[model samples]
Target: MPDWNRRSVLATGAALSTTGILAAVGSTVAEEDASTEGVATGDPPGWSSVHGNAANSRYLPLDDGFPEPNTIAWRSDTLYGVSNDGDIAVVDGRIYIVGEFESTDYEQTELRVASTDDGTLEWKTEVTGRQRPTVADGTVYVSGVDRVTAFDTEDGSLQWVREFDSEQWISNATAADGEIYVVTGGTRFNADATLYALDGEDGSIQWKRKQVEARQENRETADPAPVGFKSAPVAVANGSVYAITGGGEFKGSGSKPGLQWNGGVTALDAKTGEKQWGVVLEDGAFIKIIATDAFVCVQNMPDGLEETVLDSETGETVLTSNSTRAATADVRVTHDTFRPSSGPITVSTYGTDDSWTASDIYYFPPLIAGDTLIATRTSESSIVGFDLESGTEKWNWEFDGTPHALAGVDENTLYFKLYKADRPTELIALRASDDRGEGREGDDRDETEPDDDTEDGSDESDSDC
Candidate 1:
């Protein structure tokens, strides 16, 4: 039997319906005096969205006079493990992450904020979902299983929440031009999905992209395929939102029963959810999206080993490579040609030396921090930093828990999401330093003083647990 019918259509589809519980759930507070002007003060340069900024170029350009790589800044005093529960966002000197902490007696999803200066807990509040928190214009937006919640960056107070129907769930979200762009998936594989453009301030449904609607119009006498997205959107960039479609199919009482799912990329206007262009991708088990200004990369696997690159504005094939990158249900990333991946990294020194290749990496992209490339080990809870120029390992950190590169705040500091078996999840920040004793200072950036500022930054602070 079909998982749903026209009735299931209530939850899915891009109707301009106010189908959500629109309300700001908490006390409305005034802006903090932290900003010199009315603008949120301390909202200096830092990572604010999934891949950091609209271009999604995971790269953070550093200042010339900053410290070296791998210095431990501070880890959240709360030792919760943050693995895949959520991603991070940094703005106004505050780092934000979402995680669901569950125990025998307690279970809750929290949006956590800490001071970037000291890793001091600023405030944490119960929230709805555990996707990457998108911080912009002093508000933090989070996507959960079925709803999108917005909280104030100042105190974690609720600003607004938009609850979608029970059958639909948020896959990924990013903010651009004061609007929130979201891609949602259906509970069942064939249940069809939707793309939504929502107002950032009050959670209003500005418009919803009607893929199914368009399909229905075209097939007036036939059964229209519901728009499905196992994972839809890349990030909002260049005034456009990019997404990959699982390509809908009908299995019962339809013209195309058991229709094979087609893989493809769709680009929509960021302001208006209208289709700008789309290109079909090869049928693959998993499809991931990596977008740069010049091209959109569709990877066949999470490691980006088999991939296709399409022109960003026009759906023209520009290039192709073997690959994939991380996608929860298979999809995610940035601009710039230098995307770090799980494949062996062969760095060229261009000198009287042979190039070095780092191997056995997990099938995820490494976090790029200027000249230092941070890669996670495949089998253990370890992260290694390599000098791009010398093509050599500069430092590394082995943690008791696994860590995912979360953000590069500046040239000097980077943040990570750490996860252990049964622990809830936590975020950690590290400062890059050039000075060390004798050997490599490749140690986990943990237990360092909040105010540590020295040549070595006193590696004694590294508990290495």
Candidate 2:
């Protein structure tokens, strides 16, 4: 049985929009006038998307100066209260983003938008859910509590909205050509993992592929099973969308042994939700793909876990390695019944702890800029970058606070936002270059310091709870 919320989809999106924290600089609103120019101000200076580009390259070109050591550019304060892990997009110069924050009044989540220029307000349409916004066809696409929506980028006007029967926890949206794709799932026991394609212009349903249940069983609780798509699907030039899903409850038993439920990649026809190919991965394997002329850099597990790269066309194994990183999931048991499991379960072969241990990470999707693949890794404490082509660790930049949001801008810069860290949540810039001359600063760009004349907009002044 599927858990469908009875609330109106519009109401849910409106609800999620108001909740969730989307911090930019984490600083309070200063007295000075903040710029709302965002990317419109000029060249995008930091991580533009979570994986950086549609290619999901956490990698950036190091020829010039990008992510160089410790260099902060313009650090603008973000919307006060909301929290955001939503990937960013740069269009028409403005940096459009949706973040969630705890509302002090009702202790609910709030979504807001800030400028990339000086971090000024650009009209934030409040909606619910943690799904990131996918900007395409001149419209902004996002998932709320129970639906996908498209908003006019020019005036933040509502273009069209489509509702779903289930709730979407932290999903991601992808778009190519004229179609918008969305994946929905959450921490609840519902594992209806399915993919949806909506018209890019009017938000009509192009197609919906009901995900098949995995042949695995629950290792812990026998009460209910977890299902649904947790990862965002990547759109390819081959006219298909790629993504992963957890197979839930084979034979009506939630848990399974061996590779039955670990996970796998499913390719769907873009025009019509047709299944192209599906591959079941090893017991603990996860897959990520990077497109290239030679081959798509299908990074297997980024952690010490092993991974096999398959040919994009035929889904044939091309490369295999156990040295990559894959995102870690917290499928542990908690005191509350609402928690995922009834006991401590291993989400990955890697040890199940919060540390940066090889097992506690998910290598961010690699960024493909020019001939380079920029890759990044994240945890509650640090954010690091690596070169996709050589698998060389270009740089490892640590964050004082845990970052819920991260994205790559170009070959030379990576952008990220930190919360509960030392300073106000910040949107810091790193120079990606190799010409660090010893004592010389790795990044020549001046750090983004608050202007003296601006108002004292501190993080404390943030919205509500």
Candidate 3:
């Protein structure tokens, strides 16, 4: 399973220069003094950013108080070897993770920041690359294989760092209104993608967008497909951003070999990089986007998993849904590979196909929590949930190991990550039960209704100001 373009040049380093570390990390910090200590009232202030807000629509209307028979309201284990693409960020009460381990003499990556109530710690720092932690306004946006720091959620220090001159990598990052939205490139097979828009206080840049130069109608032996960027740029509320671009690896000419391709969905203008519309998919390549202040939901891949919904103001398209829901859920899950254990998982509802199964063994991709629709199991350690209108199940939660980052859900809490092989990577939190009396019962519905008729509306995009 290596070959994420050869582990993307094994996560490089050295690049910070946009005014050399933004005047050595100091200025930008006042969003009302980045509070929470002042705490007051209001609901959606928990899962602070990254998929939970900014219209990435990882969904979280909060209030049910999550953790129903799901147990474990705390568990830190001090974070040992946590990198299955590490990620967890829940501001105000604080959480922010990102790990990696191996000591004797190499591989590090730290960045802790704990305490969502009990699992204390408060600060750690180390860091190098494996991008993921993104909390905004008070700041805390990291990204490595090249550079893009910016901490200080109140204590974690280091306020600015930019880097990136070429050997790209960046990827996962997104903050709103004050701006952040990263996405770099070059993981070998045709690198070179860009898309900046920094300044969430001081990282600087504001608008970059570069990746549009692949056109070769067989210039004798064919060779012009390396256009980069395949994920990471979701701002949506109408001010725009959206992102996704691919179609690289083609290299075959004498014996015909290399092939890897697929890309499309652009949108830009989150302040003025312009280009407000772009589509591309005729077959696959656009594995997930979300957006929603009314529409933008793409999915597209291998042909049958098509979900299209655009129109976040003018990107057009409207409603497509070949079936695939989970983060917005009207209910839909067929299953062949989100891990697949022995097969059969089905579920169905997004336009019919009439399904129901649930044979177990999923690896993640099915989370709605409230009326339930969880599904975790990629070979045990458990997590069922179901009942999004009677798929049944209702409660399951087993856990001892092997969960690794589900992170998303908060009306009571449901963050995740667990390891086992020698221990160390805990984090958990669970605690979200809607009270079907006690456990396993079914038919409850109404976590806030609106299962899917589209048009729910919310992202007027001042980056969610």
Candidate 4:
């Protein structure tokens, strides 16, 4: 494994993490017959977004229209090798993937797009090594060291690349109304953040909104610091994009006199990149974020202080729970690492621990189709899925390796990459509907159970499932 920090031009710190305060709010709905409402409604379409549709719900909701685990027709081999922290895009019956491989110099970071039907080589594009990639409007968008690039999804050609001035490595982009809205410096600690809207047709800056970091620049100073995104920008209803940036960056050293971090949510006009509304949250406050067509869920910390249902259009706090923030905050939430991949051969592994020892925390954004939510954890090595709406362990699968990404071709099937942390570098497909069972009438236990067995011969412990 290549040490990611050494090759950085700027401070390439940790991945995104969301820590929130809450008293364990219960899942809103119980298990009844699941419906395909917010999830994808059409036939065998390719998995596009990180959460598969801006809603970020990892659910694929293929109502009796997907392949079972027994029917994997083919797979493909990657160039240089495979990586856990990559993604796939499918279009026009072809599968496109950004697979990381070991270079001749032993540095890790490369990307390739393969075919989904037979796992054949389509086109390959190399990137600076990041996990989440958003594909839309016939272009594949990937973020590298200090830049974001758009690739022709069909032939893997470079359409355009826009490099940022600052080294604040940030989160993925959310596309709405033919525009890509993303955050820069949302991941690096104490780094100033700027929200950018990029043109989908060509990689051009449409508009930008800057948020000042309170702390001074400390990259070369004697002081040290821990880096992270205070809040990730999310998409709301109407023609708006919502996210929480900072009053400024936080300093690791306690000697600073200024505020550590200023938290707030800014709503921007999706089409024009105009500032519609902005609110600065209280200090040490964590936002419980969920955006729907009708409402945006912004709940605060420890006492679960305020779970507000804001009007998606007006940005008005329509309703409030008035609870305090929870004690253990919700970790930063983002898109799932992996979606469905296409290639010649697909092989991967998984792991789950009741101990919650994973490095990356994942949440299935509320699947617009019928409120089905999915989540998982990926660390040095492991993968586990839980129902987002109910917090029930759906299926827990473990392996002796680290998986960087996961996605669903259909609700019944899933795809993932097992990095070289504890296992071989390869991709694998599994039965995503393993925990799926017919919902009983009026029973509403809407929980998924563990499967009897797996494709491989390893026996799994069902306790975590």
Candidate 5:
């Protein structure tokens, strides 16, 4: 196995999810009952943003949906992939996606709104963005190369555009509690990075935090390697902001050129930008992290490494392991679900010392929704759900189109990108059951079709959907 790092992961356009290390082998496909229970009807849960929420935990706290969906809800017509920045954002009864359609020249960028109740196109707006769109407080925020643009949910109209100068590059923008937290930095080594909190109503910086650490080195021995937050993504939850801070380049025996080392997770006060606590790695750097209100999970190095779970409030090791290896974090939350190539799904949680390893071909991101673990495999076009604790196979829903990425989950529906070879991709929704009888009563919203306005939300691109 190769030593994995951030640069290698980014180059592949995929992430080796932080779940436990594994070797997949035997394959099983069974039609199991995906019965769902306990739905709060007045309002169904929505994926709303990346990794389920601002915390980026990937853990959607919904009791109504079955993680192992056994039926298809609806599928969108062939949709082309544009310069995608993030996954689909589910809000209210509508889903917002960034893509292109019927564009042979690839110049126009479109943001389409559709009903999750059934895949109905509600409205389309010309928008500029790359990462996953974030819907918050009636607005959809999209971050691109030069600026961060906002669009209204009601009619997909232009809300605002926050542009930056040439020296500073916008990394990512996450919204929470009426404020959008953004990170901007220079790509060069040892460059300064800044985090800005912006107002949700308009593109205005509320507060900015710039924390820079100088390179520390021995004049006669090692090179100066500056380390800080750089351009890493953050998790915001419960009045706290968490980021994996590291920097520069290392020349260890088999070290890669563009990868950073000596990095770990750091927690800061969300409201004040004050540093709270941090756990820096001394041996190997962190691969990924997931932050929840209860715990923060970190996935570290060496290809076959396990998981590490830490208490969110304190920078303390709370994981109890019976194995010879240390614990891991972040695997339980949302991840860029990837195929492990070969490995049995080895899963363990922090709550109990007992663990289980289930035989499966590929283990994508371990998204724990209620009691079901929503997993995907690359062997065949299939989505499988496993019993979160017992590792029991729930259901394997296969499709002819290739499944790209797991966007988000809402109520009983799982939204993802599916593409056919040489043809444009499609937006697919999978459900736990075939009948709407499992859905909460009144889960459907009052339908309204707004006159979509192209070029309405675009800043530097042509509007065509």
Candidate 6:
């Protein structure tokens, strides 16, 4: 298993200059009827946020089936100087992007919006630091090194800006209901971690919760010890904020070893900054959290990956699996390799225990679209989709350049980008096929399918890459 670090896990995508493109393309903002306070505007019927929606399920329910091979609908013109890590956020017809653009004289980060039909540059705003943009209620929210700003979705005008007093780094904003939730932490070692809830309309601070505190008992001899939020971003569901907080001391000349780290999930009321329940994950670091209708799945890395599913109402453990990283209501992706360069990736169904029925080897995380599990081949510019139930290869597609990120997917299209260091980034949109064939039957399969095979054991299969 490869060791995962904070930087690699939260690394964002980059963008290129639209200096001339913005001038050539002309657009008008669509006027939407105003809704009551605390009510968020609806995202278009597709993949809106990075995690699909506010619950961070990363599951897209498309009735029109998944994308098939060799179904290219259109490809946007290459955008030069865009980083390989930059991502796109789609709302209605608007596509929001954040990335660093480099020119001969200088380099700067930018927030841009483009049209979904033609990928035309609508507007661009210069920003500091790079973080993925979040859109809701006709507004775009962006976070920087020490502040969070909101811009009008229509005109690219600054609506509100909220700054922090201390040197703090803010994570991506999760907007839901009528509030925006963000996790923040101190820049210095052992600094405190905080979660802030701001108004969606005016950016006013409604409530703030301190999750962890900084501590330095032996400042002179021991390394600075800090504790704070360690997860990538916070997940909100059932009127609650789901996040993790933990910290450990760096091993120094005189610091006490093995006594510095602990973490767990802490649930708080979304309306007020009050604690509901907390579970301590002793000797484990909380890596990710995904909230769904049935459970709140948490990824804890003590040695390898350990996924725990807890009841949404009561934080009780309902199911547990080893090496499981991604999950939907029916299927899970698990493997022993931490940074798998070329190894088996298990596709399993779980009820109380996991049943590894299918396998593949991929460098990036697999995405579940409807009943199919899609993944990119390890060290190759190809992607394959597999049926979750029958373990059959449904479709495969090869790209001209190395695929960088799976931007998103909607009912009729799958969006992704290709990378070539000397060339501009190529954004491609593929038409999703409506013919699901036999795989559509797996969607209604029982959660507790037969597990006659060995429990928690993976099937050895040859790589088809």
Strongest candidate by lDDT: 6
Which model is ahead, 3 or 5, in terms of TM-score? 5
lDDT of 5: 0.54
Write down the RMSD of candidate 1 (Cα, Å): 11.7
Q: What do the candidate models score in CA lDDT, each in turn?
A: 0.53, 0.42, 0.54, 0.42, 0.54, 0.56
The 10-residue segment of model 4 with minimum total lDDT is: 342-351
Give the residue spans of candidate 3 off by over 4 A: 1-88, 91-115, 118-139, 142-151, 155-194, 197-209, 212-243, 246-284, 287-298, 301-304, 307-364, 367-429, 432-465
Candidate 2 lDDT (Cα, whole model)? 0.42
Off by over 4 Å in 6: 1-45, 67-69, 76-83, 103-108, 187-191, 212-231, 247-261, 302-309, 318-325, 350-358, 388-390, 421-424, 433-465
Tens digits of per-residue lDDT for model 1, 198-276: 7777777766654632132113365534444544445655556776655533211212234333455666655555556
What tens digits encode model 4's per-residue C-alpha lDDT throughout 227-281?
2234254553444566654443331211124524334445555544445444443
Q: Is 1 or 6 the stronger prediction by TM-score? A: 6
Per-residue lDDT over 1-465 for candidate 3, one digit per residue giving the tens place of the 0 to 100 score: 111110111111122213223433555522222211211112135565546665555555445524455445555565433454225777777777766543332224656676565555656556566566788778777787667777777666676677776455577677766777777665422325677767777777755656543323224355434354564555545456677666643321211134333555666555545554454544334535776444566665533345555555444464555434344434444444433233445665543456676765454455565566666765566777776667877677776667755675556656666667886555556665433122221212311211122321222221111
Per-residue lDDT over 380-454 for candidate 2, one digit per residue giving the tens place of the 0 to 100 score: 344444333233555566545555455536444445554564457656544443232112223324444323233
Mind giving the per-residue lDDT tens digits that candidate 6 earns over 1-465? 112111111111111111111111123222222321122223234455666666666566656557574455455543322445326677777777766644232224666676555455666666554567788888888777666777778767666666665355577788877678877765323326667777777666666666533233223455423345652577777666777666544322212234333555666666654555555443333546787544677765533445566665555566665555455656667655554353567765644344544443544455667776666664555777777666688987766666666676665556677666765676665555423211221121211211122121111220000
TM-score of each: 0.67, 0.57, 0.32, 0.54, 0.70, 0.70
For each of the candidates, give the backbone clash count: 31, 101, 17, 62, 21, 10
Off by over 4 Å in 2: 1-49, 59-71, 79-86, 102-111, 168-170, 185-191, 211-237, 246-260, 284-304, 323-368, 371-406, 410-413, 418-421, 430-465
Shift of residue 393 alpha carbon in model 3, Å: 9.7
TM-score of 5: 0.70
Q: Looking at model 2, which ten-residue stretch has the lowest summed lDDT?
A: 9-18
Off by over 4 Å in 5: 1-45, 65-70, 80-86, 100-108, 166-169, 188-191, 212-227, 248-260, 283-287, 299-310, 316-342, 361-366, 378-381, 433-465
Q: Once model 6 is optimally superposed onto the true structure by TM-score, how far is the C-alpha of residue 159 displaced, in angstroms? A: 1.9
Model 4, position 269: C-alpha lDDT score? 52
